[model samples]
Target: MTKEITIDDLKMYRALVETGSVLGKNTVLNIISHAGEAAETILRKQNAIDTLDRIITQQCQAALDATGLHHLIDEDGDGDWSAVWEGLQELADQKRHAERNADTYQKLYEQRAESLEQAERERDEWRGKYDESETARIFGEAQQERVRALHSPEPARYYGTDLNPNRQHDCAGCGEGWAWPCGTIRALDGDPNAAV
Candidate 1:
């Protein structure tokens, strides 16, 4: 017998295609969800930083008023707003520079101290919650893989599948084709065993 195709083969191919589509969709959703959560965390920290800036501004204003600099640079015949603004700007710039140039060891010590302080504030319970969540995520991923493996249709017996990406096969199925790959098979021309 030269070659022949059958209906059973087509059914197998269709099942494999369907399974791959499901896996791709689910994996994409998982990645997008993770990214969204991380983005929210970053935004929360950014908002805190903005609040800190506002507090610093108010404090600077109060300092200027109390030091009589506001009166000395008074242009509105009320307060020296321009000089106050300039001097405050200079002070803010210096503070930012100092923060950037902070000694690594000193900064590390401060960071550890702050983290320790926070941990204490939470009574060590916050880390426990984090540990539980991490454990859950790890197991959830394992369960997902198990479900996919158990549910995803096995590769087409005769040739390849979506999971076996490099398997030799035709991209487009022929009209009632069979075992031997036919019609625009990518691997046919490029395959190592094919005519060189």
Candidate 2:
């Protein structure tokens, strides 16, 4: 195909035409040679660009064919890049949702662990109080038993003749002779009116 002249090429041509009559023959020839060289460079650059574009297109098409992703291309052979962009956005959204759920579960786990620890501490405190009360109860019973043993009654003794006998019972701890039920024994048996 024939190449169209650009504005820059037209301007160069106009400058050459205007200077051709005043310039020497060698100068005119040199100007034309330089113009030709500039045009050749532009053509070479355009050819290289075209070759690179073709190579890239061929490689992209080959990759799509191998991956079986030809549906991502439109009927005009252009890639539907918006579809890929939307898919990436969806994945990012899912990742954000998963991270939020993980944070919620982690908070719940920490709260549960803290609650369990609190319950265990309370249980230990209650157990300690129960042990103290039980020990007090056992010590109180032992002291009560010791008091009962000290104040126990013995057999009655008579210190007179058979006609007029004075009978009295002896205390086991103090060996004192008194009435049948002693004051100390009555007090140990929880009598409120017992005298000591």
Predicted structure with the largest lDDT when compared to the true one: 2
Q: Which residues of candidate 2, in runs, are more than 4 Å off?
A: 1-92, 159-170, 174-176, 179-181
Q: Cα RMSD to native, each candidate? A: 52.5, 9.9
Task: Give one digit per residue, the lDDT tens place, for model 2 in 72-166.
Answer: 98777788755545655666788899999999999999999999999999999999999999999999989988877767567666546573266
Model 2, C-alpha of 64: deviation from truth (Å): 15
Q: What is the TM-score of each candidate against the true structure?
A: 0.26, 0.44
lDDT, candidate 1, 1-196, per-residue tens: 3554345744564465557843455565565567568878989999999999889767766768654576564443455566776777777888888877777668898999999998797976888899999999999878756543333222343355564445443222332222234322323335664332
Best TM-score goes to which candidate? 2
Q: What's the lDDT of the predicted structure labeled candidate 1?
A: 0.60
| Distance from true location, Cα of 104 in model 1, Å | 45
Q: What is the TM-score (0 to 1) of candidate 2?
A: 0.44
- lDDT scores in order: 0.60, 0.75
